[model samples]
Target: MPLYKEIILKDNAKLYLWKITEDIEYLKHAVKLNTNSQNRVDSMKSESHQKGFLAARMLLQHIGYTDFDLYYDTFGKPHLTDGKHISISHSHTFSAIAISNQSIGLDIEQVKEKILKIASRFMDVSHLENLSETEKRIKATVIWGIKESIFKIKNIEGISFRNHIFEEDFSLEDKKATATLKYENKEENFDILFDSAEDYIFVCAFEKQ
Candidate 1:
């Protein structure tokens, strides 16, 4: 699958989204890697992961980094070797990569109705009550995307969706939302850019300061 879009943000940040297709073998070949022994029996899973990683690395290279080595922090958040803030998220066959000088968080998820089942875990009463019935499910997915981005930026695990991840109202009219990080006693705000297209939705958050 090729990249669907490349967004250039205000501060030299780049957001790349790659479409996923059903050709698992082709994707594996694109990465020039053989499936791992454990994943050999599951070609689909292996290919999806490989393709996402390869596409992300290519984006990193375009920004002047030749080597792409990903290691997780203590919280299991993936980090780049040189300390740049990078976040990756993949759902189904689609993958997204976001990199910036400022700390960043990004997430990509296939738009699906299943999100409705878990909406309460991530959204507050106010957020939930505001959505129209038709829009509520879609909004749930968007909230999930924001939460994922928040998690990657904080590089911390154990935060619950209901308690920690909070958001200001997002609108399709404006394509923007605000998320807050409440840790200890301080609050930090981040801007969220949302793109919803053809069965998929992506969200990215960045520290404005």
Candidate 2:
């Protein structure tokens, strides 16, 4: 069995993390349950995708929905036929899912010092200036996660953390932050939440609109 850590935000969006060490059979089961294609290669890739899918499915199950449906849009954004919004992300051993009535996104990252070394490549000079050595490493991971969440909600790719990602002032004492994403002329506000559970840093963003 996998161990799951759940975070329930004050706004009601739920974030779930499953540290899966099980065999790949769960993946095969997921593919069989969701798709109709019987092509061998498609089945293989679909199975690979299921590590994240089953984790998300378990979360939906816990929330009291057994017959939920998932479909992807043209931009590869995952959506529910029942009208709920969902987002998923996975890294290494952990997979995460976030669901909400409104638009939401979730990302799980293993906290590592390497992220800090490469922070300048992803973060603007202003973002670089705002971080302190004591928290710079963790904050860098947070920005990486925020960028991912923004991408999921906006359903676009090629966004840079430095120029495209804009966020509210985050103090060292804050475990959460808010950000404003600028994709062309439009701006969307998102609330960011962070958790230092196990060896990973989990970040989630929910659109306030």
Candidate 3:
């Protein structure tokens, strides 16, 4: 499970996913990491986290990038040295990245019943109307991913998922959506694309042009 999938969302934007099926030792030797990345990996307490980090590097390499070409800002947002927009996300067993000429955000989350318990916190419960229990979970997870993606793009403080981001009504059949980010007298719109695979939902948010 090296590169799970590569999606050309637009002419200038692409997405990559890496399935973390290799052991840490295998990954350690499979990819090359910069000193900073090596130290960061060494500081990780959980093997899962280390593997996720390594898998992200592997995905970057698949796109002709290495850890040396990536860095994080003060807000912990990742950027490429070549002035490309990059965003990264990792859940339990998968890591993903999106690179674009313009700003973009990417997020992946496992579909779990637990999101239903916190549905009220992040999304409009009414949006979940007329759907089965399974649909509810999927919708909730997508909405959560939507907000997370937007947050990554903005990476601003005081941005509460429940309070700042808003998603419009959408259906699973559409496989697409839109969201608004309203914070601190600033308003922005995003084009959203999403799909589910193997019980995981990944969402991509691109700044409206």
Using lDDT as the measure, the top candidate is 3
Candidate 3 lowest-lDDT run of ten: 1-10
lDDT for model 1, on a 0 to 1 scale? 0.70
RMSD of 1: 3.6
Model 2, residue 112: distance off in Å is 1.7
User: Could you report the Cα RMSD, in angstroms, for every candidate shown?
Assistant: 3.6, 3.3, 0.9
Give lDDT per model, in order: 0.70, 0.70, 0.93
Runs of candidate 1 with Cα error greater than 4 angstroms are 32-47, 58-74, 81-83, 128-132
lDDT of 2 by residue, 143-172 (tens): 888778877788777666778887775753
Give the runs in model 3 whose Cα sits over 4 Å from its true position: none
For model 2, how big is the CA root-mean-square deviation?
3.3
List the candidates' TM-scores in order.
Answer: 0.80, 0.81, 0.98
Candidate number with the higher lDDT (1 or 3): 3
Candidate with the greatest TM-score versus the true structure: 3
Candidates 2 and 3: which is better by TM-score?
A: 3
TM-score of structure candidate 2? 0.81
lDDT of 1 by residue, 10-93 (tens): 566788777766364554354432244124325445556765666554554455553335555566666777777778887766
**Better TM-score candidate (1, 2):** 2
Worst 10 residues of 2 by lDDT: 32-41
Give me candidate 3's TM-score against the actual structure: 0.98
